[model samples]
Target: MTKLTCFKAYDIRGRLGDELNADIVYRIGRAFGQFLKPTTIVVGGDVRLTSKELKSAVTNGLLDSGVNVIDLGEVGTEEIYFATSFLKADGGIEVTASHNPMDYNGLKLVREGSRPISADTGLADIQRLAEENNFPAVTQRGVYKQQSVLGEYVEHLLSYINLDNLKPMKLVINSGNGAAGHVIDAIEAQFKARRVPVEFIKVHNNPDGTFPHGIPNPLLHENRQDTIDAVLANKADMGIAFDGDFDRCFLFDETAQFIEGYYIVGLLGQAFLQKHKGAKIIYDPRLIWNTIKLVEENGGEAVMSKSGHSFIKEKMRAIDAIYGGEMSAHHYFRDFNYCDSGMIPWLLVMELVCTTGKTLGQLVNDSIDTYPSPGEINSKLADAKTAIARVRAAYEKDAVSVDETDGISIEYPTWRFNLRSSNTEPVVRLNLETRGDKKLMTEKTEEILALLRQ
Candidate 1:
């Protein structure tokens, strides 16, 4: 039996030839079909060059296993999530490597109701079955069909905001030549039909699998310059950018300054709390102060979950949370079957902008000032564990409280920080926040970085 290195903690991600391929992907589809035994499944792919071939292979495997497949041709990851529940499909899969390098490709899977299938929730078992490569012969093959849920998906997104409330605004949307362009186009059409006054300035809007603008990952500062420049040139109200699969969308304000995802969490939390009072909100442990304060002040319960989509989704489902967000730019909604969407967050945030009669910067600047942070800082060290231990030992002695939910979080009255090591690499991530004290945040961040590096 061969071990599949593509099976990651949450999804399948790996190099194309050596780790992931059409053959291995077919095995995964068969294995998934066998594991869940779902009668019907939905499948889709991103704008990667290999995505179509891999999607076809996986669909064939699923069909051979007696699972009918509804193929959503050339869509973003969230489209699969939406179609799974909308079509009442028993399962769904998206062949996407997201922001990974060009030579890599991956898959994201979900069970009924679009619940994620991660390591703890049938991923490991699927991996085992695929590795075993032992399957009973199929007597009856399942049907295969192609469909587009673009209309329904766009309407669902628009449901979050009122069309009449939208003011005249010009926004820059940079798809980075990924799968998000089509969805943006559909939304723009809806806006025009409804006579909404939002004008979209598209940048890198075409879905070129070659990723002419460097891989569609706006998280990298180097890749964000185009979106920022477009925002500045147009003097747009806001700027939005997405990765290859469009599962995560980054934002910029009128000044073309990138707004940290940490503050977006607070902004979105407040937006939901406005309508869904007394609702529960879930957030990750990496960054907390701003979100917790916003939720609590707005008469909502704030729950902390371990970082990662699976963990956050599970916690959101268990707690019946109205909304959940991560500093990494992933947002989950209860209305959307508790699934994370890169599309929903911006819509909700834009709604907030119009209703409050505030600029995007005005909406988030207060939180940034009150809870100063450097966002998430990553450092590569050979001995990540030892470095984490070193920082914890140094801080725990003087800390008021220590939390080990995902990693180790040390808290003081005015400042708190969480340190977690990468599950697959020699990288340590640090997220620190100060209670209205930028100087203290900077000083402490430097001090902790020094200790971890040492």
Candidate 2:
């Protein structure tokens, strides 16, 4: 039994050959099958070059343990979620690294009803069992079969919006040479078949394991310029970019301005609240002023959750939230089994634009102006804990409120910031926003940076 180092707080991720390979993945599958003891499971993979071999090994492990496997080849992370719930499978696994670099791969696992399998849930146990690598084989091995859920998944996405209400708008979609191309093509085909008035201008739309156009991470400023440039050059109404697995999507407005996930959260919250008055909207603690204000003004309740997807989904399920969003571009919906989807967000945003007859930029203009933020900033430090402590000590006394929800969050009347250390790296991330004071936001951001340096 080899001890694996890829299991993380949320999911599994690691460098290709050194940390993860077919051997390690097979052990993980056996361990998962032994631990969860599911009768049947759904399996899928992203477009990563190494995912196929790893997925095959995982399937073999599950089958050897008498767990039937349903294979959905080359799919997005959300597709695993959908297949798990839609097919009523006992569990699901997607071989993906989600926005990680080229030479990395990982797995996102979920149990019945697409419930996330985090550290607290069942990942730690699986990790321990995989390390032990002692699994008694079943007398009868399980079976493996292929299935395509693309049509059903496309139908699920279209269920979010009324196609007749959609206006004739041209959109620039950057698949980032990842796994989103197939699904995008599926949806476009449906639209074309129905004569829906949506025009899609695709770039880097083909799924390439090599990632010839880079890793498709829109969070990086350098990675986002292509989408911006494409939107401008095509004169499209808006632009959307998806990560490797297409579970999260970033948006750009008609003006070629990148819309931060903070404002998009507010925008999406408002969109849902308009239909379901007094519905609960879940948001992370990193940036809250805009989301809180929008939810309350629209007759909806704003609930705050911890930073990670597991925490957010748990909170949403508990509160029966109609919608939940993170500043990192993850958007979850109640109708979508409380799972996040890169495809749903853009579809809903387009619906809003079509119904309101407003540009994407115009829809979010008020919120962006009302509460400006510098976005989340990260700083590498030798000692992140000491830096966090120092920053807390300096601001705690003068702050109107302090929250330790996921990290250290300090709030004053005009500005607020959250300082937290990364779970995966030796870095502290800072996000600050103000109630209409960009200058104060910038000043406090610098002040926080100085404190971190100290």
lDDT of each: 0.92, 0.92
What is the TM-score of each predicted model, taking all chains together?
0.98, 0.98
TM-score of 1: 0.98
Q: 1-454, model 1: which lDDT tens digit per residue?
A: 9999999889999999989998999999899999999999999999999999999999988998999999999999899999999999999999999999999999999999999999999999999999998988987899999999999999999998778788999999999999999999999998999899999999999999999889988889999999999999999999999989888899999999999888898889999999989999999998898899999999999999988888888898888999999999989999988988899998988888899999999988899999999888999998888889988888899899999998999999999999998664568999999999999999999999999999
Instruction: Give stretches of model 1 more than 4 Å off.
Output: none
Locate the minimum summed-lDDT window of 10 residues in model 2.
419-428
**Candidate 1, clashing residue pairs?**
none
Indicate the TM-score of model 2. Answer: 0.98
Q: Which stretches of candidate 2 lie over 4 Å from their true place?
A: none
Candidate 2, after superposition: displacement of residue 215 in Å? 0.5
- Model 1 scores worst on lDDT over the 10 consecutive residues at 421-430
